[model samples]
Target chain A: MMKQSNLLAIVTCALGLAALSPSAMAEQLLEQQCASCHALQAEDYASSTVQERAERKAPPLYYAGNKFRPEWLVQWLQKPERIRPAGYFPAAHTVPGPDGDVVDSDSLPEHISLSAADAELASAALMKLTPYTDKLDAVDYEVGNISWRMGNLNFGKFNGCDACHRDAPDYGGLSGPELYSAWDRLQPKFIASFITDPVAWDPHTLMPANDLNQAAVQKLSDYLKVNGEDE
Target chain B: MRYALVTLAVSALTAVSAHSWAADAEAGKQLYQIYCTQCHGINGDGKGINIPDMSVLPRDHTDTSEMSARSDEELIKAIKHGGKAVNKSVLMPAWDKNLSDEQVDDLVAYLRHICCDK
Candidate 1:
């Protein structure tokens, strides 16, 4: 009975260690694989080569915990789609205006696939992200106000958003989805990235890059996203 | 006297053609409910259930000022070709494959009637 008890204790210890090893290994692999494109924490890439290229083709993953589902993240990394369709670098291959000056655009290198184990680790590590939720909540705007109505009109008219996207004016060009309620559909982070730098998030998109600064981008993203909370 | 009669006949034909051009808003309202209400909402308010899931928001047909700005041609292009053709979100799938050209025309007419009260 004493010998059997010792064997049981060893087996339990071994099982616990084995379970811990994969999670640890996953964290290490995530640090190796994704640290190049995503900032695991704000400081992880603060002075690294990736940080130097702050205007990367992809958004940082530091807020993944707040922004995404673990299952979605896992699936996304395994089979990365062109989420922006246009390409990660929002302004790649765009033509200059009548002024004859070329615009700046970001370029993304080819993506490499990760093994299933590596993907699991990366997802686990990425889920640790959380940022700016307080600020996001503080700045939330009303969607049904007159200002929002005006913004929607401005987007279609002054900005010529309808020139390419298929939003309002009853009829317009069909290059983009109608913006009648984009705010409710897209992830806030993704919207912010697109608003901040289209080319950085997508490399092959045909949408012309607007010269919107960060503040304006956030405002636009907020306007688009604040509508139809229940829907 | 014969020329006057011919002119009157042409005038009658023109009137008929004009009347035909006037779309049936009632029919459009029904069609919108059946086909477009999924994304565009029951009252063209753009609050449909799928609106949240879609990357692009459906247009609110009630906004006359915005609708007035777009030409009929532009609207037709979007419906026939997907959003990508116009540098927009690819989420708005092309209805050309599913809806006939006549149906698209009717939809446009319906949009004008609902949005512009035309």
Candidate 2:
């Protein structure tokens, strides 16, 4: 009876340790590497001024779960790339050129790449971060198709989003982030929310709040989804 | 003394009317830096940082002749309503949702300062 009781005690202890290890280890990894630059906490975006936003070292990951798909986040952390070609704020990264101001890509820092194991752990932790849960819940998205011609007209001619964001690789404007892989990278609800009200996510975001209605925002999000799949 | 007082009153009235007519260019400048500079360029020269990838060039606010040709009403329409409203490229988004009517007037005043005031 005593032997059986000791065996049960050991099993309970092992299970307890197993449950604690992943979260504890993930926290250690995040604190050691990501704490210096990335904002892991929910920030008061409404109170942050333009100048303050411009000076942010890295994009906030407090809403990572809401913003990024788990697979994409894991992959991205493993093989880091420049998502915002001109850095977070294009204005701060520009220099004089013959024709006009040019984006100084060299001035931007390379995103620190993580090993596969570390990336998996980091993404697991990041995927649990849903500080903007209410914002995410507010947007409801269904997979829909936008025809190439109609999508082009809406994105370029009507809404003028192509003026800043890239709809495809080497296509559209350069000021905003490339949207060619948006479907693969971002959550649909997050995309819709951002398009509908950019200021709510980032108060000083250069992307103008065009005040598009729910249907309009969905249409635009559909346009992006179809565009992303093309590449 | 009566004649001097009449002249003084007339001068004061003229100053007040002129002041009321003028919009706040300084406030407009701040708004421009936030909303317009991404495509319009920092100096309003049409060659913004995004110019490399843009299909259509932005309007150069420094072009005095081009700006002078456009009336305040047309300019205001273009700013408040999108560029499509003025029969131009739709690349310019409408600011009606974001900016107030008074703010639009201030932006026009700032545009005038940049182009015509030298």
Candidate 3:
């Protein structure tokens, strides 16, 4: 009877340990694979200098939980694609052309793809890394459909986001990431929070904090959410 | 006595020019990169990355004839109050919140340097 109880206790402890291992293993995998290029810790990149910005291999993943949707992250990890066509730093990858500085697509490298199982683990771990708990909590998304005309006017004309970001394929600016997949890739709250105050998220980020009111922020968020849905 | 007066006038003029040169154009170049390059091109030739999408092209700072036509006050107003303030394209955003009066002056000086200094 004593032996049986001891065995049962050991089995229970083993099962608990097994349950915790997935997350622990995922973290270990990230440290080994991602830490070399991607910043896992919330280390601020002093990207004030052009050289420092150029040195960045990948976008910092410490804010992944705050930024990316879990489903998107999982899928993207398994089938990685170039979000920034010119790579992280456009200057390094661009060549002087007749028109202006044109991005050299040949210079860009393919992002590393992960296995299905690894992507699941990695994404799960990434989703748990919410350092900006307060910022995330404060996101009040005013959910609704924004008309194309109104959205375009606001994003392009008023806010000048089209100055850096693309709203559709081969359209808009090349300085920032293509926003066509913003709704699918990012959380609505994250999008709103980011637009409301870009400097709060990253001090040296190239994005300007337009000091927009809550209504304006919500409208912009909605615009981004529905940007490429029709296309 | 006349020679002394001429020398004093020249010295005063030199001081003013020197101050303007030192404080404005150089500072403006740095600020332009931070705030304007996305839509104003790295070379300030008006062919920014966003040019393809924009209905109205950003003004070429390197256009000597066009830039020389506009007064410093007009340029300052446009920079501070956006294009709509000057009856220009509304695409140009107002930099009133982002830039100070002094900074706008510096940007105008830099615009002059790029457009007219050739």
Candidate 4:
């Protein structure tokens, strides 16, 4: 009877060990390194004031699990790259040239990279962050194959998005983040939410709320997907 | 002497109010650097960095012929209410919420001065 009791105690103790779980370990490491920059437990997507956001050392990754593809996240974690060329705010970053373009490209702090193993662990932990999962359940969308011609027409001629973004690296305008790789970079649901109501995510964002429905936002996402795949 | 002093004070008070009401192109230029240059370009030429990203181009402020045709009231309306108010693009966000009435007029003054050399 004592032997059986001892065995049961050992089993219970083993299960109680928090470090035994990969997720727990990931959480530990995230607290160690990433907590300084990323809002690890950020339920609030809108971080704070304009000055606070402008001086932010890094972008929030609270929705990384839903915002980015695992493959991209893992790769990106290993090899950090600058995504927002013009920083976060149009007010803070934009500087006029003698002509009709931005003369001054604001300096952005480099993203601290992680080792392959650390990246894997961090990616796994980040993947578990699904703050929008419940909200996304209500946002039903059907991603279609948007044609390039039609997509270009809609983006450039109709919606006028091409004014701030481009379909290709060398083609589009500056100011907003580049869009050619948006489909791959951003999660489908995030793209939909942002386009549907920009103020919902970032109130200070220069992007005007166009009042697009779910369908229109999906179509735009689809167009980005098509364009993103080409080059 | 007291009459002269009163006259001077009245004139000085009127001047101060008039100065406050008059648009400050310098202040407008600073605001433009912070807000408008991202989409409207530095020189008001409508060819800002996000030009390719936009479906419709921003109005070129350097286009004297085109801008000259527009009255100060029309420009002020567009600045305060956004392009959609003037049946233009929706991309231009309403500055009514962001800028003060005086600031909007200053921007109008700046635009007028820059585009038309008025």
lDDT winner among the candidates? 2
**Candidate 4 colliding pairs, count:** 15
- Tens digits of per-residue lDDT, candidate 1, B1-118, equal 9999999999999998767667545555544554455445556765443443344677777799988987888777776675555666654445554455776787788888878874
Q: Give Cα-based local distance difference scores for all models.
A: 0.55, 0.82, 0.80, 0.72
DockQ class, candidate 3: incorrect
Better of 1 and 4 by TM-score: 4
Give the per-residue lDDT of model 1 (tens digit) for A193-221: 65544543323223335555665665566
lDDT digits (tens) for residues A1-231 of candidate 2: 579989999999998777878889898888888988888996675575445665677877878888999999889988987777777767777776788977887898888889999999999998888878899888877779999778878888788888988887787777788888888999998999988877677665667676688878878889888888887
lDDT measured at residue A119 in model 4 versus the true structure, 0 to 100: 91
Q: Which stretches of candidate 4 lie over 4 Å from their true place?
A: A1-25, A28-49, A90-100, A103-106, B1-35, B42-47, B52-57, B60-118
Query: What is the C-alpha local distance difference test score of candidate 1?
Result: 0.55
lDDT of 2 by residue, B1-118 (tens): 9999999999999998767546478778877876777788878888877777666789999999999999999999999887888988778877775667987898999999899998
Question: Can you give the lDDT of residue A59 in candidate 3?
Answer: 81
Candidate 3 vs 4: which has more TM-score: 3
What's candidate 1's DockQ score? 0.01
By DockQ: ranked, best first? 2, 4, 3, 1
User: What tens-digit string does per-residue lDDT give for candidate 4 at A12-120?
Assistant: 9887884367777788889988988766765343454333444455566777777788878788888976566666555455555554566356454567889998899
Clashes of each: 31, 0, 0, 15
